[model samples]
Every structure is written in structure tokens, then in C-alpha cells.
Target: MSVVRAGGDGRTEADGTGRAGLRTLLRAADGVRIDVAYRPGPGGREGRGGPDVIVVAHGFTGDLDRPHIRRIAAGFARRAAVVTFTFRGHGRSGGRSTVGDREVLDLAAAVAWARSLGHRRVATVGFSMGGSVVLRHAALHGGGDPDTDAGRTARTRTDAVVSVSGPARWFYRGTAPMRRVHWLVTRPAGRVVGRYGLRTRIHDKDWDPVPLSPVQAVPLIAPTPLLIVHGDRDPYFPLDHPRMLATAGAGAADLWLEQGMGHAEHATTDALVARIGEWLEKRG
Candidate 1:
């Protein structure tokens, strides 16, 4: 069953926009309890919605309540209602982090929850690891999002999708940061650090029969308004990643290689965030 709470602290709290926030513990198709947060925009109704709603997916090791994630949500709230959530195995969510594998189910639960809240023009924006999730989710459920709840279909489709600093292919260890990330998700000792130091519980199993890569999923996102944004100075997956994605998109997606930008949410600037909001607004 889905559990809905008005605020993070049990009492509804304003999102600094004079609008109260809604928190929820949603059940994924796999029965994972995913923690989600939503902040309505100006003139936006609590359960109903404004002109648009953007689902912001945080990167690995990040959660809905992080300061950076909050900042992005606040920026997006300027143009549309914003929804953010913690993937399984992160923050207050249940289950182990499959990194990017089964995390698609986590995102599906969040999108379904947002629709249940009454939003119609819903979009998805992801950072780094989240970037991958949005792409795959849109490809899999863009038409009529397949609700993974065993037997329920929640109409969790996305109107637009944005992937910021996402990797094109899997198992890429070209950069030092990526190498460290590989260790964090691969090694048992690293999993210990991920659990204790990063507060991220990663699954011990590997991707049995590897899932679809970001580039492979890009083509399927056609007609869904795909936007791929990456930093020129990203320390993680480099420029080649986005380039590969753009190639895979084959003119179906928009590519933005921001100058001097780095990887994911930490490197995203307020100006860029505003620009992203503008992009979403334009679509609506």
C-alpha cells in the first residue's frame, strides 16, 4: 500500500515558495518502498498540478532531501511543480541499490506517485546515475508507463526527458572518479564504505544479463523530447559519453555540452538549472 505524508517531518512544510510540500512512501512494482517529495509551483494546487511537473532524479549517493537536490527542485519549482525521490537503498527508501539496474523500478514508482498526485504534463530530469534512469524509464514507459505493481497500470508517462551528465555505456572506467565509483559498487570493502560512509547500500550481485545501456535506450526515447546535457570538464564520464549518446539519438534528441561544467548535480550551476527549467517550460 502507498503511504502519504504531508511533510518530511510529519507536518507539511513550505518549500520556500509559500507552497506546502508532500512526502510519500510509494510501493514499486517489486514492492520496494520508495520515498518521494513534491513541491507545487506558484498557483499550483496541492493534489492537482500547475502547467508542468518535473521529476528530478538525484545521482548515485544522493537523495531527495540533499541540499543540491533541493536547490534543483527549487529552481524547477519556478516554472513547474517539482517531484524528487530517493531511489531504493538510498535515504529513507527500502531495498538494496542495484545502482542503475533495478533502480528503473524506483523511478517508475515515483512517476506513478506524481501522477496520483494529479499532475498531467509530467517531465523527468536526471543527474549522472539518475540521467541513466530517466532515459531508460522514458524508453520503457514513455508511451504508457508500465506500472510494475504486479497488476496495476498507473499511466506514468513522461512528456519530456532530460539527462544531465549521464554515461553512454556501462562498465566504463576511463576516469579516476569513475574508477573509484566502480570500486565502490564492485568490491565488498567498497560496499562497506558505500554503506557506512556514503549511507548507500549496494546489492552484492552483478547485472546477471546486463541491462540496456544509455545509448541503446536513447533511440527509443524519440518523439519524447529528449535532452542530453553534459559538462566539458566532467571528472566522471567525459565528453565522449554524451557524444556517443547524441550519436545514438540520431537527431532525435537535443544535446547541450555546457562549457566549464563538471559532473552531475554538484557541478550544475543555478544559471544552468534555470535554463533547464526554461526548456521544460518551453515544452509546456
Candidate 2:
């Protein structure tokens, strides 16, 4: 792993290589850091413009080196600058996971890194928890109502967003199994683990999924296109989540329910690759 000091003086590490001229860059912020593996197009020169830049964010407990992440990044590398990174407290990155709260900052840092590398257009493709991070970042940074607490200055402007098997609600009200899982994992275990200063396990912390819900952030995305992909067989968020997001976003969003697919499993399918490529082609 390669370590470096982020703009905020935090320690961070990188653990992957780029295709062709592309490279991996690491950044740290206030003791929290993230790893961004950037893959430039084959014929593209460093610091030169390319087709588009796509930031691939992994799910909770995931990292830049995950097989699914690498696959998605490889798929996009042919047409755009693809970047995959580890959220804080995961893999070579530092600090604890604040659910999707602080991870937004990490995403912002990744976006800045991509911009610095000469990417003109940017898009964020996230899976599960990572999907929430991208949505929340887009909502906070996108031009929205300035009066709301969720509203903040736009840090990174994205041309589009793609979410795979992401939840629209943190509490999982309608899904009994998911709610049980949340209560079982986050409530007691999260508190216990957090007390020891260890990373927050899946069910340890009381993370308000509402704040990260794309249903709430849809309006904020406004004209920015959104592509919501989920497995019909997903036991986590269920199909209603994406359906609601699509309905809420009106025509600004499109929902793709992969029949027989499960959470994170769709990442490996050719359909996903085609869908993502089509979306980028239309929006890039």
C-alpha cells in the first residue's frame, strides 16, 4: 500500500494500479482518508481531456480492490476515466465509517482528484452503501433549496448518477428482514464496537438512512439524470425503494429492476455494463 497526506493532513493509502497511463491517487482529510484508483482511457494522455470521468464507489465494508469494483472500473475504463476508492475505515483508508455521513466528504475528495486530472465531465456509480454516499453528495452539492439543512455548497458537479441495490430509506420500514438486520447489527453491536474505537460494524451505529435516502434527494438532483439499478430478488431495500426514487425524481430518473439478481450480484452482469454504458453515452 502507498500512503500519502491529504489536503487536510490526514493519512491515507492506495492499493491498486491503473490501466495504461491511468494511476491511483490517495487523499487524507482530518485523520480520514480514501483511496482513488483512476484508470485513464488507453489512448488518453495524463492531464488531458477524455470522454467522461466515472467514480465507482464500493458498498459498505468494501474497498478499491473488491472484485466487483474492479470489474465495473474495467468496464468503464474503455470509454471514460474510471476511479474506484475505499471509504474511510475500509481497506487502506483511515478512520471509522460514519455510515454514509462522513463518506460524502471522501467522495468529494475523489471528485476533486478526478477534476485535477483533467476530467471535464463527472459521474458517480455507487453500490448499496456507496450508492447512498453518491446520492447524498449530489444532493448536498447540487443546486437546491438553500434554506434546508441538507443544502450545502456544490463541491462536485456530476453529469449523472447510477445507484445499484441502494436503499431509499435507512430504517427499512417496509422490509421486515432488513429492519431486523439493522436492529440486530447496528443497535447493540455498533455501539459496542464504536465504544472500543473500532470501525462501525454493519449493525453497530444508529445511522439515519433517511438523510441519505435518494427519495429525499431526488428533487435536488433536478435536471441531473439518475439511473437506479436494483435486483428484484434483493432482500435489502426491495423494489419499492427504487420505484419510489423514480417516481419522486419524475422523469429525471430511470429504474432498472434486474429480475433474479441479488444485491451486489448484478455488478458482474453484462446487462449492467450495457445499461451503464448506454446511460453514460447519452449523458456523457
**Winning candidate number (lDDT):** 1
Model 1 per-residue lDDT tens digits across residues 1-284:
13345554443556444567777688888998888888887663445422367899999999987999998888888777888999998989999999898899888888777777777678899999999999998888867543344333336668899999999999999999989999999999999999999889999999988999899999998888888999999999889899999999899888999999988999999999988877776665
Model 1 CA deviation exceeding 4 Å by range? 1-11, 44-51, 145-154
In the order shown, what is each candidate's alpha-carbon RMSD?
4.2, 5.7
For each candidate, the alpha-carbon lDDT, in order, equals 0.85, 0.69
C-alpha displacement of 96 in model 2, angstroms?
0.8
Model 2 per-residue lDDT tens digits across residues 1-284:
46665444334444355223334545644546566666665454455432377888888767777777777777777667677788877766777667677788888788767766776678888889888888887887764332333522433556678888888866565777566545545676545554344343333455654455667877788677788888888877878888887888878788888888888634448657656876767764
RMSD in Å for model 1: 4.2
For residue 254, what is the lDDT in candidate 1? 88
Residue 282 of model 2: what lDDT? Answer: 72
Collision count for each candidate, in order:
1, 6
Best by TM-score: 1
Each model's TM-score, in the order given? 0.91, 0.78
